[model samples]
Target: MLLDLINIRKVRRAIVYFGLILAALFFQNTILAKVPILGVTAMVIPCFVVAAAFFEGGVWGCVFGLVLGIFYDLSLAGTSLLFTILLPIIGFASGSLVMFFLNRRPLSFFLVSAAALIITAFCQMFALLVFSQTKVLPLLITGALQVLWTLPLSFTAYYSCRKISGLDLSK
Candidate 1:
């Protein structure tokens, strides 16, 4: 009986985690786009990926990252195959790396966020350069800007997740 209850609790947590991911994605796509400053610029999917990596470890984080990345690609208007494929790989690597170095310190949030941004930027740059045959310099600049915006947002999301889920990630 106790084991079943525990399993149920875990299942509930997993559901809540996935629910939050979906909600964040939706908000990022719709309502967030309306805001003048922060809207449309935020990298909510990457932030959620970091959160999943932090809380759920490597495998699950990678899976969630793939799902979030695919959703992101789908939300866009034009046809972009690379985005759908590359993002998942990036997410998987970032999540796995973060979990490998899993620490109990608060600084992990910043570190993980930074790593996520860097990985995302690199993936984007690669896609633009190789697949799209675009100018690397402009893509690099934009990727940097995106990283700057994503850093703090990732931290905030991680903090909120910890608060809501009551997961003591701090050491």
Candidate 2:
């Protein structure tokens, strides 16, 4: 009976992981990309990664980040190795912070989302500064803008996941 319960729990976690992945890909390819922004665009996949980390901590958050990073890299046809390193770092950092402050207060949710966006933006900025040929200032500016745009979305996703999963983060 105990083994059956463990299996069921594992299955549930797997389902949630896959579901988040599909949702991330769909949002990236369809919803976020198709939005007719005049000149600027937001990085929805980062927001999704942030949401995953905020809601599901520990190894799950890292896994989500790694998977989503690979997907994002593949879809963009850019270097996959860079994102494979960056995304998981962003995920693990943000998720670790969330886990550290697992209080279920409304404020906690807001803080985590903000932290996720900030961390992701910083990662992008650092990567551009170190590896990419792009100008550092523009990358930093755009990353900052993207973080602002993504924070609200991350908050909504995190809150909704908390509600649906019945996971009390306030402890």
Candidate 3:
């Protein structure tokens, strides 16, 4: 039955998404965290979510994003739920925007990834500035640095998600 097939597909997708999230978490904490550059680890997380949105549907992107967000938030010293809330919204928006006005192209993927990074970094910097005595200039500079690091990684993430999702959003 169609319903049975749908359910099975959902289960398979869940498994794949879970695996990706777990790997991301493990690598983020153990390896990527040690990278000489700060914020690189943080930026990579949302790239995966954005890639999911590009290759799969909004539903898939949102679910993976939510899970990644929760893990990302919990890892931080602060209990900020910004990642938990924002990535899913970004995923959903990415999928919806692509569906409405873009083809599945490198440019499209870049734009979506850039938008995700911008929004996430902006919210994070703004939150830091507002809630603490952090200087705006430093926050902005850090965000820019993170974005620079994330750009190439976004392409990798996009291709990786396309492979993992197996959804071909071009349809």
Candidate 4:
């Protein structure tokens, strides 16, 4: 009975996560891209990964980030290597912060989400500077604002992950 319950929970968690990623991808590509806010669209996938890290820790974070990144990269711009490498790093950082110092609070969620976005921006900036012979300052400035625009929704991701993972953050 105990093993059955455990398996059920695992199955439920998988479904929840898969659903969340699907929604994020759908929202990002279909709706958000068409109607840009100041010519910037939100990337909710990383927020989902960060929330998963905070709730389930590094292993789940890494796996989710890796798989989602690959799926995302197969269609989006740039190479697969960027998202594949960068998102897992964000997950690792989110997991580290959660494991070492933070709880699954909204504040923690916001901070982790913001950090993930900033790191992603930096990585993009670095890639642009290295590979593309184009100006990166504009990208940096806009990316920072985009990060800010996306930060408030981290709480939504955090709560969603907690509900999906069947975790009680109050404990």
lDDT of 2: 0.68
Flag clash pairs in model 4.
Answer: none
- Candidate 1 per-residue lDDT, tens place, 84-160, comes to 66555655665676667666355776776777677767876786699899987778777777778667667666775
How well does each candidate superpose onto the true structure, as a TM-score? 0.76, 0.76, 0.87, 0.87
RMSD in angstroms, all models?
Answer: 3.6, 3.2, 2.8, 2.7
How many backbone clashes does every candidate have? 1, 3, 0, 0
- Minimal lDDT window, size 10, model 3: 34-43
Across residues 1-171, which tens digit of lDDT does each residue of candidate 4 receive? Answer: 778557886777778787887877786789657765778766667898898898888888887788778878876875557888878878877887898899878877887788788887777678667888668778787788778767775667778888877877566
lDDT of candidates 1 onward, in order: 0.68, 0.68, 0.80, 0.79
lDDT of 2 by residue, 63-94 (tens): 87898778777877656475677678767876
The positional error of residue 117 in candidate 4, measured at the CA in angstroms, is 0.2
**Would you give me the overall lDDT of model 4?**
0.79
Residue 123 of model 4 has an lDDT of: 74
**True lDDT of residue 5, candidate 4:** 57
Badly placed stretches (over 4 Å) of model 1 are 1-6, 35-40, 79-100, 169-171
Off by over 4 Å in 3: 1-6, 38-42, 167-171
At residue 2, give the lDDT of candidate 2.
75
